[model samples]
Target: MNSPLPPLEAPTQSAMPEAMNPSPDRVYIGFDLGGTKMMAAVFDAEFNILSRRRRKTRGNEGQKAGLERIGETIDLALEEAKVTHDRLAAIGVGCPGPLDLDKGIIFDAPNLGWKNVAIREFLEKRYNSPARIANDVDAGVYGEYSFGAGKGARCVLGVFPGTGIGGGCVYEGKIIRGTKSSCMEIGHVQVLRDGPRCGCGLRGCVEGVASRLAISAAAAAAVYRGQAPKLAALVGTDLKEIRSSALAEAIKEGDTVIEEIIKDACKHIGVAVGAVIHLLSPDVIVLGGGLVEAMPKLFVGEVKDAARKNVMDTYRDTFKVVAAKLGDDATALGAAAWAVASLQPA
Candidate 1:
């Protein structure tokens, strides 16, 4: 379920000082389009957040309505920021699912039931501003690379384990990508030959064994077998009730089995990270998403250990595994920053 939206308010005094703030006309919009919810944020050229608005995606409402809702969300944000559309410099969006990046279209979002979504064209036509789109995970990793956990690193890898697992990489300040699509699909990498089927129809993929949904399923079974009494008491055997925070609470209440389940999942993720290490050798690997947010210490510690353990000794200490710092704002901020960066003259 999506979290409640923050109450709308005017730009705070924490905004950049007048001297450093960009010209009134130099504002940007960054939108995060997720499966459950979507958010729109306005930022100054310096990237200080000005205002934000959030809304449920309501994917069942269909594509036309969903597009309308996205526009409305952006309008509300621009209104709250007291910045008119005329002042907007450009717009950037971080979107989920397979994308035709060169064409700025989301090719498919199984969760949202959206396909061939011409998000960039919609934004540009609606606001009469230049627009760009990228994979949401790529935007998030870029956000961390630019200002959060992976700051100052030469290469940063981000792996987010949520309903499914998502991965992104930033090397030398540029988000690494294929010629026409986003790459670094770590979750789709096979970990167990002929293991359980993943949502992607692939057997033994990392996401099949290690995503939050996968973990929740495993924990729910423990609840059914009467192993996770604390979790059972808190949320019963319903898979929908086994949220990330709830799992964390169960572990806190001495549910050692539940903790073990999480560790095992993180270990799978680490195995994937170890493979990436052999290829990119990133300076930092950032673990983000609700699962990591709810149990940062355990996830980071276990993944770190497992990753180090699986890799060659010579490659040990070559990378640091860390948690994301920007929380929910990472995608929006990163999308906006990417807009500015991508638009710069070569």
Candidate 2:
């Protein structure tokens, strides 16, 4: 059950600034925006990170403060790299959705506490450079496809199971931008009808079942009831300290309770991924994010089996599920790719 939000206004496309010329000597800047932290990097055409900076997002201070921090991070990265704006080819940003890609406007990002903020506009003004905005997962897919594991794949699906379950797809070489940029909201896809409530108020969403938040919540409940011994021992009195890695570690140690929880979560994730395989039949499926990276044996293998079991035999035999190669830098590198692609004339 997807929550209903007010209609978002279309983004206004700004003409590409003349300064965004193709120059091998120029550097590009990329920013990855999150609820708690923001990271910026300066890179050359070859994708070498010349400099990087990070800052607390300060999302509670509202959109203005978040944007300010993002600007500061970009500035600091450029300053550290000793590059002037003239040497910058473009700036790319990867942020949480739902976004209006055409207008470079973000409609609503629950994690960032932003609604209808013109992020690209703000970035362009702040840095005096041509800027482009994309959903974080989409940017990551682009990053991987352009330079990482999914390179040369005809169709690639990137799934990240983090604080929330989010995904993005690249069909052939282009990012799949659905109607109003709503394509690939994989997290909100309903896996169970009338099931667990999601942060977006939806029931039985993929994220509601398989996200780190959901897993952590379940762990907390189990701890409250004294169901998990090893996990409790590892985290002490605070259930909040029991992260996905800790849970994975407990499962690795063969703790029955933690194993069961992980199995349940994996089943949900597998089912959801199975749906993706059935529908898209992508050539490559990249599973990433903190949980998948930490518990590869558990999460990745389980999802592969579940998808193979549930998907059509023809599709199952054709698609390959693998871990993302870029890991945490996917967003940043993808943003750089977006900037390069967007700035180049078609």
Candidate 3:
């Protein structure tokens, strides 16, 4: 996900301290590109936030427009930080995949309706800095490992269940990656022989069975059958509005149908976590994203219990599953750290 920079054309000690600015400048930028939104952040060498900008993805506007918005957001962030391209050391992006990381090309991002985007090249050319791309969840977990809940853990497995279930693993200090792309597509790991269709167009993947989309689909069916009166009264069959907090509200209202839907979703997730435990034997499994943020105890407790039951006796007590702690800043910080470390000196 990185290319050699053209070399630092100019280095100024006034804007960038000598030690921290060896490669170019002390400033680093990180961009988090999600299905629904894109965000950019500027950070000092110590990872202090200088500025941040966020905007809707507008992906339906197509690839060209989407890229334009991303660039604009980055410029806005840098401007607000009172920094310019001259101060930039490197840039990193957290994007959806399966991607060709070596070429910085996104193979496909179903949520963004994108294909084969040369993201790293675009950023490097525009900002004149070395740039790297990483899977969004991979970046998130790395952030946590570096500064949040998974800090100090030698092996960390992250499962972030939102619109879909995204998984990541950081072993030792490295975010596991294939030669061409980031590895650990845990979401696509088969959980059911025949189940829901996934975003990736596969059948019975853990994502299709355990994600927010799956929960929403179940809630919709319940509302249609008049089995979830509280949920119906709250969101009125609008799946978009049935986000994590809404589901929590429904559960608090004691809606049996909604509760069942949630339980089923958790069961699938637990199964997947159990499998990951046996395969990776991570020191910690960090459960994150919108759903876990909304109902941390319910989601984490359920998944942990089921996963424990599924694992072999010797492995059952090995890893602890916990919630993510870094919130919105995790991906950005992780990306910046990855970029700064991966990029070469001038």
Please tell me which predicted candidate would have the highest lDDT against the true structure.
Answer: 1
Error of 2 at 160 (Å): 1.1
Error of 2 at 265 (Å): 1.5
Mind giving the per-residue lDDT tens digits that candidate 2 earns over 251-336? 76656777777678778877887888778788888888888788877777788887788777787788777888887788999988
Error of model 3, residue 189, in angstroms: 1.7
TM-score of each: 0.91, 0.90, 0.88
Write model 1 residue lDDT over 58-129, tens digit each, in one string.
Answer: 988888899999999999999999998777887889998888886689888888998898888787788877
Error of 2 at 262 (Å): 1.5
Query: Can you list the residue pairs that collide in candidate 1?
Result: none
**Error in Å for residue 166 of model 3:** 0.6
**Model 3 Cα lDDT, one tens digit per residue, 1-346:** 6897788777542222223346434799989998888899998877888999999998899998888888999999988999978778878899986888767788898888999898887887787677888888899999899888899898999999987788899898789988888988888888898876787798999889788988998898898899988888888888888888888898899888787787788888888888988888998999999999998998888889888988999998999989999899999888888777665454
Identify the superior model by lDDT, candidate 2 or candidate 3: 3
Q: What overall lDDT goes with each candidate model?
A: 0.90, 0.82, 0.85
- Name the runs in model 1 displaced over 4 angstroms: 1-25
